[model samples]
Target chain A: MADLRINLAGISSPNPFWLASAPPTNTGYQVQRAFEAGWGGAVWKTLGDPIINTSSRFAAVHFNGQRVAGFNNIELITDRPLEVNLKEIAETKKRFPNHAVVVSLMVEPKREKWHEIVKRVEAVGVDGLELNFGCPHGMAERGMGSASGQQPDLVEAQTMWVKEAAQTPVIVKLTPNITDITMTAIAAARGGADAISLINTINSLAGVDLDSWNTIPHVGGKGAHGGYCGPAVKPIALNMVAECARSPHIHIPISGIGGISNWKDAAEFMLMGATGVQICTAAMHHGFRIVEDMIDGLNNYLDDKGLASVSELIGKSVPRYSDWGDLDLNYQVVARIHEDNCIVCNKCHIACEDTSHQCIERLETSDGRSYLKVREEDCVGCNLCAIVCPVEDAITMVEIPSTELPMSWNQRQKAIGSMGQNEAPGAKEAV
Target chain B: MSDYGLFQEEKNRLDAYISRQFKIVGITENLSGATVELEHPGGGQAEVRLLTAEGRKYMSNLVIKQFTAAN
Candidate 1:
């Protein structure tokens, strides 16, 4: 088996799968259960001063029979007293000595409060600390969670304070609610954060019940926007991870968290520069046992790829991610229909004729048999025909000769501007 | 206008076919000849260089046939 173990910013884990700080990691018992289920680590739910929570603190949206495609939560950090959470953290660490137990912490923005919390959590022998700069709903209003996370300066100052008092490595968890997440990531690095975990949930109103006109998971017939997570947020989370991975300004280990459901999802995040990926909704939906497949599958994937370990997969695809202008505009592909595989439902034909470019032609052969063919010259390679085709493997996109050479828009502009000529040539010189 | 004509007989059919099939962006007439700019179906602009009588006759016939037959 390929080595699945990972040492992220000095905090080592048996594997790269960690339970995100959520309901799944709410207590020592829950975390111990997770370790038993084969998770390498768990960031115990955010711990701080106790607070009263609403009765219905969670709401979820489902799509195509998938439970909680997007999950929303109004739940605050751990409601248990700080001492209780601290004691549990110690107990959990003692029980799972090899497993990573990073304490998630949130406290007043004051320097002393952060210092005090960091010291207490570190004293428990936890592997590391993740600054809960991200709970985006009820906690931000109190200027404790996302309020500080949204501001880079605040993230820097708070992280600095925690780092000053903490013995363990600090992982600054970031909020997705911010305009540019990198700003806060860079700030955390400046403040001496050992690692970064993202993205904390997005601010969302789950949905309103049309009949009752009430927000979902209504707290006493009323509702507030909560933090959104789960499957629907994976694309957003992946994009953020890729951006951070590509940027040289922020150099820190990333613990990717948002809508990761399986080992494939974990691999994508890892390839995009996350050292480990913390998961919540899947564990919430499928229980902690899901990590069994996550661990085995990742090991199989690494072995199949001829890689030695999970660290080898990290940031492997970062070089391929780039701006739109950097993409090769001259690269072209056209749709090709397979006569043998085509079901000929006329879906692709009709779609191309009415909605997209009218490039498909239904031709009658010499034997009075009719079949659809693409007018390649007019195809545009838009894939509209392929998209509307019901049959799999019926239509395939084939690369064709391009009008331009291998050059991007950015390169084209540079070539034009370098000659000290104001007026650039037309089509003749574009390539 | 007829002095340098190549396919004077097919001009009307080609014009009707090209105009009905594609959107004409602009036509520029330089000292050499005319360049008819037409919007490509996918995106961007495709220029038909009618700089010479032969060039005009050849390109117009090819594009007109391609568009009209596809329809």
Candidate 2:
């Protein structure tokens, strides 16, 4: 067994896994069951002035059979009465004393409204507060969600107001719609946010319905771009986390969100210096019971790698990440496609030819059958084609021998730069 | 089976099978050569090699398995 407990801002959890503020934590009953099932905490769904929630509120896209690759929603902040949500939070906290229960809040952009929400939530025995400034859909249109986050100054001022209003720790959930994440992060840190979490989701149109020529989740036969989250957003979320971690002015702990579906995804977030990983889409796609796999997977990974504690693995790989110049110039690879067992699908060829470098070739058989092949010279070894290919044991990127090719781009750039400087046509310039 | 013997057998089987699949100037194991050059069936050259010990182990184990591209 590995030590999975983590202490963030003086609040400790049995594990760093917290249910993101979503439908799973929409009520105390839902959250209590989540804790019993081994979740470390639950950020009770975003609470605001009670409003009407429409029927048919969500739209989704599926990928690779069982996974929800992307998710969108017209859903607004918590529609349940504030007092009812508060009562549930208080009771759940009383029962699961060890688990963290942070309440997610969204309110009008006023000092009085925010101050009142903070005071009321803290009295319910929550360990912390995550200001819901990141919801990019319905609430944003109302000037309460991402609209507040898009302006850095407003994010700063609102966070400070909450800090003054609440005695417990406060986390600012940031929107991904911003061009620069560091600006918002720095603003939150300046405003006294104990931590920062992202990214609420990106505004996106999942797809359009061709029959009525209308878009999906059509409210009155029209659809707006809703916040996109799921496995698809992991890379974008990861880059933002690293940016915030690397920023000198923003040193607060980051609660990584967006598309974390498994322990490996969670570990990747932690390695990028996230204090904890918050998840929604994975839970929404599968169920809260998936947390068990997350717990066991993380524990087994820690044990197998000889890591004594979860903390030891946090941000362990951040130092190895660096700029392009930091990469070893000598490293190289070539794409390999095994011929005998090839299933003759042209996915690899289409991916390489259409999207990536013109590297893959398709060969025809005597019986008019054709299979995909990789061209050596053009293949930059990006592995995008291989990653997209569905067949197992199909395509692999093998490292090129160092002596086979001299520093390719390196020597070429050097040669091109010294063309005019050289005394003779092919004369070598002194270093 | 010993690792060396296993590597030798797998390498020999792959060399023979690939030789028959694509028309090429026959395959040879030049352990003395430092480079791994792969000649594509489509008149292109790839000068890449499996460098690390871990990579060689993975390649040896999976070399003989069948492969296919997805549509």
Candidate 3:
């Protein structure tokens, strides 16, 4: 069995599956129950000034036959008084000494306020601190949460204040509502953070009641846009993790968040350089029991791949994630139709004929026999034919070797620059 | 049309000499095969139904082939 244990910036856990700081980790009872259900750790829901939650705090969006594909919340951080939350954190840590207990905190972005909270939490012997700078809703209006996270300079300054007062490792939980997440990520690293977690949540209004013209998760008759999460936010979160992982400046370990719901999602994030992953919506929908399957599937996958440790998977795919300029322009592939495999489906022919390039040729023999053929020269290798083909393996994309040598746009630029004189030298000859 | 089997191998290659002899003007699908309209340098227009006995013979581009272009 592969070792699922990870030391995320000096914080130890039995596995990489941790409950994201949300309603699921709202209290000591919830955190202890999640740990009992096989979760390795929990970032206890954001703790700070107590706020009253509205009547309707959550709204979900369903598509087709699926439910809660996207979730939005008008909820604020732990509505419980801070002293009660702190006492609970201390009790939870004492009860589950083996599990990771990282407290999520968001307060006024004042130096003294951050210092006071960091000292108070670390005094309880919490494993680490996750600064919740990414909450996109309710609390943001008070000059905390995303208000402190969206600005790169504020993220850096606030992180610095926390670092000064923190005894344990500090992980800055980033907000995804920003224009460029990397700016904030690099800023956190520059502020001397121990690690980083993302993405807090996206600003969204789940939907509106057409009949009432009121926003979803409405308060009485009106509503305000809330922070969006769940499976819908996973892709956006994954991309942000990849962007940070690929950058040389942001060197801190990333705790991947957003729409992560299962082992595959966690694996993708780890491969993109996340030390571990946090889940909220999945646990919210199915309960913490889902972590059992996640742990089991991840172990099986690692052992099958012959990996000695799970940490080996982190950042494994970062080198391959690159800008479009580096891709080879000479690479080409053409579609080929298989005779035995085709189920007489003309879907591929029509797709290529009308929607895409007119590369597919339909032919008929005098004996009343007919089939299709691809004009390879005219094929742009768009894979439209393969996508539309109903039969398995009916259409295959076959690679054609580049007639010339490999030369990317980046290389072309360098070769042009080396010429010294601006004669606009042909890249094929120059290289 | 489900009458003929697709060319399964590299045999699907276009014949260089035969392809150069006539330029394909247009192709339309019908009962027997794809009706290919070709234009010769002599300003002559001819239609050949491909994926058939005669069409297969012309595609070979190797054998001593004869073509009777339908006016």
* Model 1: lDDT of residue A381: 74
- List runs of model 2 lying over 4 Å from the truth: A64-67, A324-330, A344-378, A401-431, B1-71
Across A213-288, the per-residue lDDT of candidate 2 in tens digits comes to 8777778876777888998889999989888877778878888898999999999999998888888888887888
Q: Global CA lDDT of candidate 2, please?
A: 0.78
RMSD of 3: 11.1
Per-residue alpha-carbon lDDT of candidate 3 for residues B1-71, written as tens digits (9 for 90 to 100): 32123432212333432466765444443444445455677787766546653243233222212211321
Best of the candidates, TM-score: 1
| Ranked by DockQ, top first | 1, 3, 2
Worst 10 residues of 1 chain A by lDDT: A416-425
lDDT of each: 0.84, 0.78, 0.83
Note the B-chain TM-score for every model.
0.41, 0.33, 0.40
Task: Give the native contact fraction of candidate 2.
Answer: 0.00
Q: Which has the higher TM-score value, candidate number 1 or candidate number 3? A: 1
After the best TM-score superposition of candidate 1, give how far the Cα of residue A218 lies from its true spot, in angstroms.
Answer: 0.9
Q: Write the per-residue lDDT of candidate 1 for residues B1-71, one digit (tens) a residue.
A: 22224444334434654665654444444455556666646665555555554344344334333434545
Query: Against the true structure, what is each candidate's TM-score?
Result: 0.83, 0.76, 0.80
lDDT of 2 by residue, B2-71 (tens): 2334445545544654564522222212332212334456775443233333324333222212111111
